[model samples]
Target: MVSKELVLKAEIRKENGKKHSARLRLQGKIPAVVYGHKQEPQSIVLDLHDFTEGLHHGHKLFDIEIGSNKEKLLVKEVQYDHLGKKIIHADLIRVDLSEKVEVSVPLVFKGTPAGASEGGILEEHLDSIEIECAVTEIPESIDVSVKGLKIDESLHVRDIALPAGVKLVTDPELLVIACSKPIEVAPVEEAAGAEEPTSPEVITERKPKEGEEEESEKKE
Candidate 1:
């Protein structure tokens, strides 16, 4: 669940583009944007260390306080540097606490499947599922128990039990994961006569052409 007291302090940005963004990075800040329905997109900058620390604190839904106005937002996308070690930019989507919004949360599988204990392989289709819920009701992660799952058994999105004001947004019939036995491929067997070449037909005699027969008899 998102913490009710979680809030992020952000500052409006006056510059954009690569050059200006690089200068922001040197100042220990990162470029960020927030936009949503009926709201004008706002350009801003965040303290890199502070922003990352909030994520480490397990904040899935952020209560962003910009200027005198506070807005609830979800982390939509994150841009990383070439090395993927540094945060270059981020996109935040504003949300309404009273209105339901869709967001993908990580899928957490708990307990060992019965098939897995019996030597069957467990395969997962997706790591997350989309859910529609109020900002306050958003879960940190959805837990799906695979306990007693047998071979050939599967779990779907419809099986999840959502919170009281939350609903599943993904396809109900979508297969989340399955338990199956490992397949053993057999080797191909060659036929006994496969390596040998076939014999050609034996024609007893070749008939001469009519003109050739006449010319041969005349020459003779």
Candidate 2:
């Protein structure tokens, strides 16, 4: 279970667009929007350092303390700057803990494969899985164990263990991991089904006759 501590306050901003966004960043505030269900989109601002720290802790759910009111919202989408170093904008979706929400969870592979020790390659087929579950039940990541997996062995989507109340929405037969042995290639042979070389006498008999060629040329 992963949890994060975030403090978000309700701060209204009338400014919009590139210039305004840049100015907000200069003031150490990140522009964000919150919307979901039957509610209208609410524009809000978050503390830059606090918002970033929450993300670093991998907490998508925030206990937003908006001004004098408190609201629990799930982090929906976070947009990064061009350099991919800073958070530019964020989207938060209000949710009910009792209702199931669909979200994609990252995949994590645990342990080393026995086949890898024997020079076999380990291939991962899936990087993430979608699941429908309560917002509070959302897992940070799903774990798949590859310990002692032999060559030619595979672990499918169904092999992963999910937390209680978390249901996998992906196909059960989807390949998640596979171990393959190193391939060996054989050399090509060009003499297959070829007849043995002819003897010198046979070669001489097959050759064009020198005297016949000269007589034919003279007649022409």
> What lDDT score belongs to each candidate, Candidate 1 first?
0.84, 0.83
lDDT of 2 by residue, 1-220 (tens): 6444356665766677878888889988888998998998888888888888877776778889777778888888889989999998998998887888887788889998988878888988899988888877777777788996999999998888988888889999999999999888898879778998886754445655999889889999
TM-scores of all candidate predictions against the true structure? 0.74, 0.74
Displacement of the residue 140 alpha carbon in candidate 1, Å: 0.6
lDDT, candidate 1, 163-211, per-residue tens: 6777888899999899998887899788666666769988888889999
* Residue clash pairs of candidate 2: none
All candidates: CA RMSD (Å): 8.4, 7.7
Give the residue spans of candidate 2 off by over 4 A. Answer: 2-5, 182-220
Please give the lDDT score for candidate 1: 0.84
| Model 1 clashing-pair count | 0
Residue 218, model 1, lDDT: 98
